[model samples]
Target: MTAHAPPPHAAPNAASERTERWWHRATGYQVYPRSFADSNGDGMGDIPGITSKLGHLSDLGIGFIWLSPVYASPMIDNGYDIADYRNIAPEFGTLDDMDHLIAEARERGIGIVMDLVVNHSSSLHHWFQAARASRDCAQHDYYIWRDPAPDGGPPDDARAAFGGPAWTYCEEVGQYYFHFFSPAQPDLNWQNPALRAEIYDMMRWWLDRGIAGFRMDVISLIGKDVDARIYEEGPDLHPFLQEMHREVLAGRDVLTIGESWSVSIETGLLYCGRDRDELDMVFEFSHIREGWHPELGKFAPKPFDLVAFKRALFSWQDLTRDDGWHALFLSNHDLPRQVSFYADDRAHRRPAAKTLATVLHLLKGTPFVYQGEEIGMTNARFERIDQYRDLETLNHFEEQIAQGVSPEAFLAGANRNSRDHSRTPMQWNAAPHGGFTTGTPWIQANPNFGEVNVEQDMVHSESVFAHYRRLIALRKESDLVTFGHTVQLMQDDPDIIAFERRLGDERLFVIANFTAQDRERELPQGLAGQADCLVWSHTPRGEIPRSLRLVPYESLAWKL
Candidate 1:
């Protein structure tokens, strides 16, 4: 089936209207441009490649596409370390190519949301370049630059997320600069009103071109403490962000999804203000962080807190009830695939993914599906640490090696944990490089291609791909899946993740076995009236009785 433009008069109810305005009432697929598709056969994925795959998105019932960072960059942070905010990278595509992609998407009733990486710029950015060129330059205040500590050493105890000092010493300016991520990605000086104005002007440029909005990267990091000696935050952060809202996003229909990682709900709501309306929605960091230990960095070493997760979710929902929207997501470009997290139960990839998909889609927040997630992608294995391309991975390898860490063990950890796990060439087919390129791919594709590609699953009715198609289709056709109030039942179940989505008389239960073992649980006491199974990864065959006994990894949706 091909896409035709959505009819202008396709009106929806009030609950859904609220959702539609937040995300255009659409399923958004997140694509990391470098690994999505390769049109030029240059081995690297690019915009023309993504343009070609628009049909795949259309077929999957996607309403909008969130393209992650095609901006001009040094690739230090995989395009997050932007050198130019206004131009597209030569490696990705040209301005005309992106324009055409936008037009074609609109023609297909789909919209575009590009990555908004305003928190920082690549150290090589023109602003940073000029700043480093001279201390007295007009752009010198564009970045956070400081001097040595009172004891005459590097700044106290501020750790770089990737493993070294967060501050990088600059011989040119004879000062230390703040960079929460890699040193190459210098933090922007949002404290400067002049710099904030310029960022908003750039935002206007994209909005004026009819682009829908932005998926802001590390937006919470836009504010940093200026006085704490090491890691202290001052009260001035709110005023600055409020001013940003007034200047950049106010009175516009454009959606703003900020990455409020490391920010509290209080701060999150403040960033996504109600009265002033700073942001439309903000991504809560805790969703994708189920398995992480703070000391372990981004990767997970053990199971996460489900009860804690619920508290985090409900708190945000309550806090933003009358204010901004919430951007609910489980996986994205920066982490390992969901299969890696929930796939311990090898018997139920389809059911588990379907169940997780239901929970995210039916929440009050706007749902986001990462690239390759709909068809159920998993992590890949790497034999050597040197083969990793991610800057953080490389930094960790070097750090571990310096600390006398075992080389074999280091690569093993990197293989199971690196960001590259999600960046591998998307498995399009069983062909070489998983059909991503006729030439050598920029990165190796997962070896499970024969069993995982879209082509194979599209032809099989029982395949995971087909299940995702149905799930997304359900979201498109119903208000419950898009705007309903959510109540997670059996949240305490160690092996099952079950939740209910209700909009007045329309109620549905989404249950998935997170583990492999067949288990039984008494349905939560609150579920009343007759409830019939509506959708399941497997057919609603003889299995889903009134007191359903969910199979291993089986996912089912029941209507009450």
Candidate 2:
């Protein structure tokens, strides 16, 4: 699969014709602050370190950075448990550093999107502390609390997402508080008007600081009805979202992306529908979940089924075709590396990474590049559970081991799906600690950084980073790539993932081989012809042949 000598079409001037939002044609890059880079020899990445690395992101041509949480915390859940919303974590630097990072990133046309973890606050947060100390305080009503059951146990047998019971007893208050995640993180009571007002005010404060927007953490659980065990997309969800929009997001030219683990195609539009005014997009997990064991969940691994994965992915594309927008991503701070999880990381790492990026970036949505993903990072195949740092992974290890699961068996699963795979220090160069820190890293860097670092990839001809740079540039210049409607092809083909992007008469066809073996796929009659080559992974060709033979992990895009 290749292209002819026909020159690519002139860059489209569609911005003047359409009232497009800044993000519609932009690409997002997520920065897990703790693992990105370390300055001051602290062994932990900070805002100053992130500021120093802006040139790398600028070179990649990202429009925004979805920075993971760096708020004041006790280091539980890797900063997801927020202790203070308005301040920065001491380990991550100060508020001045954050302001500087925003200013510096803005100078390079990259907006910094902060992580909003309003669904819960750290147990150490002042509000939570006050709430737990006294049931008579105003803050007591700011969190979900209920009386103990007749048997003096929890209000219900609900389980936390990390592990153990969801309800934690507050002896001082003589009641139990609900937490969807770890007990160290207490659920916020969105039903309380005062609590809502405080959240709105905090959001306004951040927006006033000139940050881009927010990538909301577990937003679907905000309107949970704990009494009924309805934690996801509850009845009050939209109303609360609508209220939040009215208060904080309505007139602001900022992007808001809600993260929903349970958002399905059936209820997709409710969050990002054109008229909904709730969120610009959602980080839904239907496609990612398809790779997990059904009943056993993420810990227990399952074989990657390409067909089912396509169905889940393309379904969202279909759902957002004419209505809501999509948030394109494969890896994140909470997920395993894309090359290791989705494709052949060991043998075909570079091409497979490029192929994955090709399929995702060409889709009609704002694509996100996780830190180190552009360089084809692999999983931290830790042999022991102690090598892991994620609370979710560590807690699950204990639970599974206690349930008669062997330590070796649990370690195998953790190696495949642990969040720490993506949390390892970013591979910057071949230097010690992957050049991420001057001191010992808080988490051990992937040992393969010597072979798969950004500096190394930038010099290679077949570079994943280079491929991503081209894709990002293509989105910014090509109107067809930005607004074209997606039409999935070869949905049933297990070895091939193909799709067409059509905007009026302009068409961009993309195809990728998802296997380690050579694959011969019959191109659709309408798609076979001489065309300008948009991008290719393995070899550049002269034309789109009727019978296309793709090398292992080869990907190509043709604009016709």
Candidate 3:
């Protein structure tokens, strides 16, 4: 098979040539507040807890923190269902606490990127309450609503993402309201000019309070046409995004990333093209979904396919080489732990974690490290269904059990792929409850925390945290790592992932053995030469020989 040639980099415009954004060279770290740290001995993690850990984040050499929602909420979907866009949840802390975090992190050269959840609001939100109470109020149009069907049922049988019908009847207003996820989250009506203005004003509010930017939650769904059943990349998507850019983002030197599960390679640039003025990048799931069962979805995962996964990932590399940008990551709060789900999390966990980090961080994009990821944290092995705190997992358990899926069988799938796996308390040390709290933890800590906590990893020479720090430092110091054109090699090799990054005469080659077995491959003529070792998981190497052999889960990168 012919090797795929690297796409040529687009010529930088006058503006881009003179200046580069901070995010261009810096890596991001995600902090899930409720699991990060506990300040007041509360079972739940709060904003102050995150502040206390700023030193740890700074030590990791991250540029920013993509903070998950700490907004006022009832915790229905873990802060996704916002009751007040401008306030913080009492359990989390106050607005003063949030400002302090932004200030403190900025002092350490870290920006706090807040989560923007505008697609929906909690049923308890004042606007939702007013809309449900009376049809005469202006807030009534703030949400999507429809008259009942002739048969006095929901307008249609559209089911919610969580479970049951998407339409919920509000007896006070005598109309049915639409929700994409749960009835508790009423979909916002973007078609309303006043509602759009409110969202823009709210975004500006956060920006003025000294935030870095926003990681928009399900932003693709904002311009959804519920009446036509067009949710993702609908007709108004680009227009709304452009308007948002012009209204609140044009002058700011901040980064914006949109989260889209339905975005595909064909429409990738529409959301983040340099000229589109929509966003800085997007959190796409095409590569992550490669391991999911086609018919059964994430719950019933298929075996890992390295070839298909490479195709999905490399396509984005090619697409963004000339336009737009990529958001590189393998794990997040919504998915299972990378080491547990994608690689060996048992005996070879450390090496496997390093290999995964090597492949993702070396890619051409902004890399984000999820909390505990740098320490190679594995998934939570919950024996019972009640142990899960995620509404998505619990709701699915109920639906699957009713459909004749045995409790044992569903539990097995949940164990393999559950959001709660990533939501467990961040293991800081070997103390009780993993040093996450002094009281009972909101969720059970992973039993292996004693061996995988950050305190232990930092002291070890070959720890995953050290590997991540080196990778982050390399990106900041090497232009080739930040802007080189990527050329993926060994496309058909199922056991090894190899790629070469080229910028002018400089080249950086990276290779990783993804399996827990010895593997060998012949290097291409262009890749065989003396070079400086940039990063490695096992033994360090000084040159790329014609024939290369890698031990189990070994990874190496060299600059040529």
Alpha-carbon deviation at 134 in model 3, angstroms: 1.0
lDDT of 1 by residue, 1-560 (tens): 01332433323445333334535356778988999999988888999999999999988888778889998998877899999998988989999999999888878778898898877899889999999888999799998878888875776668787879888888898888888888898888887879988998998888777787788787666666744743322366557667777887776666677776666765666666545456777777765565665665553245655566666666666665445667777778777777776464145666666666765666666778888787777788778665678888888778878878788867766655678988988888888888888888777888887787888867876676666677777777777776666776765666777777777778777776655667777766656445576677666743334465767667777777
Residue pairs clashing in model 2 are 3-541, 3-542, 4-542
Instruction: Give the per-residue lDDT digits (tens) of candidate 2, residues 1-560.
Output: 00101123432434223246788877999999999999888899999999999999999998999999999999788899999999999999999999899888888888889999999999999999999989889999999999999999998999999999999998897899999999999999999999999999999999989888999999999989988889999999999999999999987778899999999989999999888889999999999999899899998979999999999999998898877889999999889999999999898999999999999999988999999998899997987777888999989988998899999988888888999999999999999989999899999999898998999999998888999999999998888998888999999999999999988789998999999999998888887889988899987877899999999999999998
Across 400-447, the per-residue lDDT of candidate 3 in tens digits comes to: 888888998788788889999999999999999899999999998999
TM-score for each predicted model, relative to the true structure: 0.91, 0.97, 0.97
In terms of lDDT, model 3 sits at 0.90
Model 2 CA deviation exceeding 4 Å by range: 1-18
User: Candidate 1 vs candidate 3: which has greater lDDT?
Assistant: 3
Write out the backbone clash pairs for model 1: 20-25
Alpha carbon lDDT of each predicted model: 0.74, 0.90, 0.90
Off by over 4 Å in 3: 1-19
